[model samples]
Target: MKSEAQTPQPNDLQPEKDEHKDSYNNIETPATDAENSNIIDITALENQMRNLSIGFNLKWLDVNVLPRKVVFEIQHDVQQKILKPLEDVVNTMQTVGLLSMEAQTIFKKMFAMFDGTETEYKFIECLKSADLYVVPREFVISNELRPGVIHNEQGMDNDPITGILMPIKFQLRKYLESPLVFDTILDNLTPSQDGYIRSLVDGTIWQQRRAKIDCNIVIPLNFFFDDFTTKDTVSPHASRTSILGIYYYIPCLPGYILAKLANILVAGYMLSEDRKEYENEDLFSNLVHTLIDLEVNGLTISYNGTDVTVHFMLGFITGDNLGVAGILDLVESARANFYCRMCKRNREQREKDATEYEQTFRTIDGYENDLLLNDVSNTGVHKNSVFNQIPSYHVVLNVYFDLMHDLWEGVCMYGLSHCLNYFIKVKKMFSLNELNCRKNVFVFGSTNSSNIPNDIKDTNIIKSKIKMTASEIKTLITFFPLIIGMLIPEDDPVWSYFCNLLKLCHILMLREIHPKLLDTLKSLVETHHTQYQQLFNDTLKPKHHNIIHYASFILRSGTPRHQWAMRGEGKHRDAKQYSRVNNNNTNLCKSLSIKAGYKFAQNVYNSSFVTPQIDLSNSKILDYPSDITFNSFVAEKIRLLNNSVHFIDSFIKQGSTFSHGTIFYVTYCNIINIFELDCILKDKSNNLILVCSSIMCRRFDEHLQSYEVYKTQVPKLISNIGCYETHTINIHSVNDKLYFRFCNFNVTDKVIESLFVN
Candidate 1:
């Protein structure tokens, strides 16, 4: 285990002030005029300087403090948790062509990691992205309409995504190093007459499943510090606020053009140092070499008279965060002179303006030009000898943009926050002071929301300097556009513009991108820049002024909604909060590793063992009696008038509640299953659901469950939003909770219609 001191960070280059200050000429202020005139200033200024003891000591405050002791400790944890989000992703991937018999999904084994605490994450429950939050509908507010507009008595509550426990690193390493333990497990489980005879004759214990004390897991991690490292003169975040890397002592994980990170981390290199080869090999090469020596490199693992190929395919490395200094050798700032990775967007500004904005979409010729000139320099994949040497590592392909940070934060929140501030504070459309005052008067009444900040004193009441945090902006952007009907006029351009943005998000992030998706996205991007730009600047005085530009990246890269960096950020949020437990700043990395390790393990597990089937010999299935016949449900009220239970029907069937006039979209639905007329009332919860499996049917009487979960997969044309693939129904809430979170086909015909043939 190594502490953070062993890791080197990078320093930021050239502050904005240092770079821009010299560009500005002297202003012609009255003082500047008189000083330049050089007529009445010399003696008069001296006379005016006859002041008292008033002296303002104005120097930048530098509080010296020590850096947080960065370190890594192999938490002696073998157990792990199951993350539902990753499971959902897995299920979808399996449904798609990603997982076949040859490339089977592995690692379904259980390993317990931690005890207690709220480790569950509530997914957005629709479209596609791993960005997570458990926001309640109570936070949504509107006027001239009922409060808690999105709250559906039938909607899902605390809908959880499963997480997995961390694997025993020691056991993994040991098994990979030698096949003795793995062979034993596989051999014992292998169907052979001798094994069966031994189980029956020698010991009945062999019939039962077992898990051995795998190994005392010891992980050998490379803690390299690359010299290309950058540093700062002072940092308040560190305890001793003096000379720190741009990373603030945090090790950069993005750099390894190859792994073993040359493993700069394994070798302890700093960014400040110039480029030099430790062993004439990169990090990836070094890692393979070390693992080869360790004898655990998976190329030799034989089972069933066949070798199991374990070499991972090197998909292109993605740039995360600001991309100032990327982890892998390829990622550079997207806004650099060579701005785009996918196209020739790096051309001069005038040239960019001539081709109807060539920066957003890639033309065949432009892409070809980009390839020829840059040589795929953006990702460094197509460079000479790189692609040919490593066929598995494709260059300039599969590059991603992050939805959560780059799009939602960079553009959506960045732009929308300004719009909201303008409408609420400048236009006086919504009142924060009123919200605060109402909460002050009554804690439990209609005015109070669990989602609202309890201590918020209304920015209107105080002269404030702190801007809204990313989370606050995210909360607004995620739900506000759909629910803004009651807050603003329908004719308002701001509302229309925001709605267009929402439509673009849906088009980009939908399960199967619509055929017209690219074109629709381009139109929206151009409108935002040309049309909405004038409105915001001439009217709103936008804070997030440059958000229009980010739309280009999305159009070119496709949806980054499914990227991992944003999810990592989201998971890191949980860890970051936990690390605040002590003022001592001890084991910040240790605490985060536990959280992140479990998050990672939940996705990667021992595929050798499947989810253990329930032993039918030991347990009996219980069948619950139905309380209500299918006839008991109010037909007209339930919208069963024209509804057919056919497995191949396409029509509208919306949720039962509303979030600001919007409804939960159960539209574009094509049924996949139909049972003999039967509707069961679940115990404790009176949810009425179509009967299926006893296990799935038993949980119907719950609250806040989404109807989409139970629906089987259909053609993308039939249903696109909030859809998940499941053979069985798993509805969690009653009909009332299935609120109108979005619009129906009757309302959003054009958008949803694009999914189908004419």
Candidate 2:
């Protein structure tokens, strides 16, 4: 393993000292030795656990460099964090008379999960035998008894290995045997809008892991391509072109994170070639044959000993990989193509009023130089085109629309920038007072900071990424209902339509088709196009901005949200970071695969790390000695002076202020975009306001036995929630009417940490 010192300078984790100065000084706490020491190498720990169970006594470290103390720490953590909880539940079940006779059978299985007896690979073998399979690294349920089920929606499973749930093998078999059970399972985990956003941080390192896992592993034989920019290989070959590549995409994984690497099938590169030749079906089919021996062109994988023998279902190629593969233009390139790859239109419209190109028969046929190699003797031969080589794959649905590229960079950036650009350059509304006002509110909300939030007046990370960042686009999409949308000048109306388009992009993921949304989108596009034509005389539009033509048919497959390639793109970052140097440039293929493999190992070992309640006993050191009031959103924090202590004393006596489950706000920090603090007035004459963070009662999930987390609903993400703000909540904003009781910590000596940046 590469040491910290050995990491490349470009991928260095250490930010320059002066680069970012967080406003809340109390946000960071010194790490305790216990916290630092408890960190475990996932592979070693798994091996340790497996070895420890083989005999009776404590296991010795196989690797000499690893300290005995570290092993003890990991053992303690497993007992305290994992097994002890199970032990307690078992005892409780015994005491309550709920432990069933059928449940009695799973005792060994549950024990095996940790004792190393019942491992993921063992379960995978079972799944393969039962005609069901799962990629263990995906952290999802793996049963294929039903159709239309996408990715795992549960951010936190309800400890699926509990006394109440059936045996793992039984559950898998039941789901595979019954579609109703599968549907019930999906319904149980179907996420709410807020819940989906909350899961964003659970495994953010593997952003869009679920999507990639579903398409690549769960969808079975998904035709995919991964996108990455690598340095040239060793010695004689190293240039921009030599390091870049793509394919029918399911061959690639989503989001370049480790989850994506876990799905990588074939890795290769070459000089420019004929489009048809490069995109041959044989290329992907041969890979499938290798993965699981192809049964008459169908692939079946059997887990060792288990009855699972899952047949892999392969699909047509889909990727955000630039259409530069050059075989055909029938399918629009992910980045610039405005029209839908399935149906040629880029926006919503009537069947009769088809303004876009009609190309449902999406094959390269018109040109004399069509690169399609139609051969009669090929194994997976198609009708006329080489693409038809795959039996079940269809050209229309085969084109998987990438949400990250098409929406984030392509659609959001394209539409938002155009509107903003028009407002700035055309409407001459470059400087909106509302935006500046909100910036003041954002930078220093209820705290005395004469200056705006750091770099708000200067820095443009949004524009720095050539107009905007994916995160910025994400903010606009999510907060369109809450905050960001109001910034658009109402006069244009085009921006409003575009914002709705962005919202639709997000909504499609959370729920299925709603005619209202489709109709609304269609109407918006109709007016947007007319006004757009009026603005530029109906000239050709950027393909990304043509949501008007393709929005309808694309939904026929499912939301683009379900097939985002953001995760695949992120895998490149991990590859670049970990790749060992070979005369300066990293070996792209090997290095990438290695990084991906390590990441998969990490996931396999620590899959449940984020799901459990974080032990914050040492971290939650905060207090509020006195009441605080603010006269203005930009005003300084004020301690109460002889003004009625009634409010404070009353809550203090009730013990409702700082106890568990009491929600509170820490008003000094900024949680802009998702949940911001805007000035509101309950009493016009009062000179005081509360200093708090935004808080809301997170919706309870009986299934997961936890709460649904929403970014807008909870003010945790941007704030230093772990240190200073964890105990605080924000005041109700003017626009958002949702307000719970204000909370304040009992001020102790520990509260001396600076609450705001100077």
Candidate 3:
């Protein structure tokens, strides 16, 4: 990142020396010293004006005013003489551009302005004002050293764990001034707009309110930390790099608009090969030291005759299980007796009795007392967390569990592998080759093509633990029932148990969580765990123990989706790409940090907060026919807009894509109904009218754990619900009959009752 304007020197006034000129052979020109003085050096003069101090420097006229640099000016009559011909060329170039051969003529005419000319300069009077420009500044983080042990080179020689830190205040100030937050707040600051802004406040049941967040601008920040390998895993020269990422969401704008702004990488360091220590207090202390002042004083930004004080508070410290345990100074080994971070349960206690896990929830006072003991065998605490330096943050309350690691990769992989093995070897439903053939032939939609899982290997199946990515596992599980639903028996206990896991996944993936939904999630997790132990005759893994605290975590924090490590892990791709192209392994951390700074500056300059545009070529405007007739209400609605309707095949709005065959739900007369989009109509005012066909909800199938529905030929007319309610569906063909199953969350009993009431 570049710094603010630097102070200029007096020697900068000298003109450049020509290399071709020789003192002995130079010819004396007719121009004298008086004639040469008429020519002004415009570049040097501007530099002198920029660096002049008001009180210290003497002005030419003793007037306290700064000067604005101006280029050559054009006369009024001269501009009008060429205006018509210039307009003609501009109009032609606008219609036919650089792709065509005719653009050469336009370029020739445009270059005439600077063919050959002597430029003139002027200085305009302007008042000097104080402006703010927040730039990224790098700070050094060093490991601890013994007293009287001085290093020759600043911590690089003695401590190989030295890292780079980007101060949080500078990054926060830049974000607050960005169009994402500044423009949105300035545009809608009225009494009626308070409700819309207040919804963006972090108001989870467990979140403590430092100030009235709704009235003031409060930024709730979530910090993510993880380690990723930049080199290929198969290669002998593999290297591991640890990264720290920051994420914040603005309440006024929709969540999807800010998706690209999440997971900003701010700190990183290379992991040493010889370092095997569990705790690093010095590393984290340097990172959070700057945040202490930010939490108390708050950042004040002045612009447009107003000073806005914005507060920064820690929302959550999130990462994978290993990363989270490392930062919190807990036992990093999952196989240890005291493994879980949220509770203190020994292996014997977990295996013998699974109930009352909440009775041993970790608290602040308990953690403090355990720090005094400094024993990892009993309390699982070797040292205190560096994040305790922040005022309102606590390790037990702020650290969140990641579903990408715990459920998708851990529990889901283990359960699915066992079920597949049982189906192949014991039941003799189908051969493994036949199953792989079906998996290869299944057609995934365009949006999901990149997440397709690889072929399942025999070795993985035999071990009862599959190896796959989180994205692949999620995609496969979503359509797993549809792929092999018919092969299994209708009343298989193993298949039913797997469905319970599916229910738990759907609920956890939701962006918003209701109190009623938490009850459903808690029951589903308990039942899923009990079923796993009874069927497999095995004890709970460490991930299973971590899953026990999710409901309690969500009750205090917001949704788990916002705290997952998926986005943090995704950010490693940039670093890997940079490493591949440049092959710079010596100073990898510093190189990645500089690249991140350039990306951040580009995002701010281009104003990436703008909404996505819709392409009109994909749609067509419909013409009204004189022969068609409609009912009174439909005719009146059409007449209100003079029968102007656009029939769109597909279009994007607010980062969501709507197409002809999309499935959504809407409330009509206080009842929710499932509607499959048949066509879309837009009037002159741009309000959408959905022409959809209703799919009747039959019943919530216990065996499939999804809603069994039959698509009806009934057509319905309703307005667009702005995509607030939607669900994922799976299609099945059983004996030449079509079956539809919809997976949804927050399904209250009233919604289920309403579905079957008719």
Strongest candidate by lDDT: 3
Rank all candidate structures by their TM-score, best first, as comma-separated numbers. Answer: 3, 2, 1
Worst 10 residues of 2 by lDDT: 159-168
Winner by TM-score: 3
TM-scores of the candidates in the order shown: 0.42, 0.45, 0.72
Output the better candidate (2/3) by TM-score.
3
Which regions of candidate 2 fall more than 4 Å away from where they truly are?
1-223, 231-237, 240-285, 291-306, 321-340, 344-388, 430-466, 476-511, 536-551, 580-587, 605-758
Query: Against the hidden true structure, what lDDT does model 3 obtain?
Result: 0.59
Cα lDDT of model 1 overall?
Answer: 0.31
Please report the TM-score between candidate 3 and the true structure: 0.72
Give the alpha-carbon lDDT of every model.
Answer: 0.31, 0.36, 0.59
What shift in Å separates residue 83 of candidate 2 from its native position after superposition? 28
For candidate 1, write residues 286-371 as lDDT tens digits: 33343333323333444556655332222223334333123333334444544444443443441223123444544434444544
True lDDT of residue 724, candidate 2: 31
Model 1 residue 233 CA deviation (Å) reads 15
Q: Candidate order by lDDT, highest to lowest?
A: 3, 2, 1
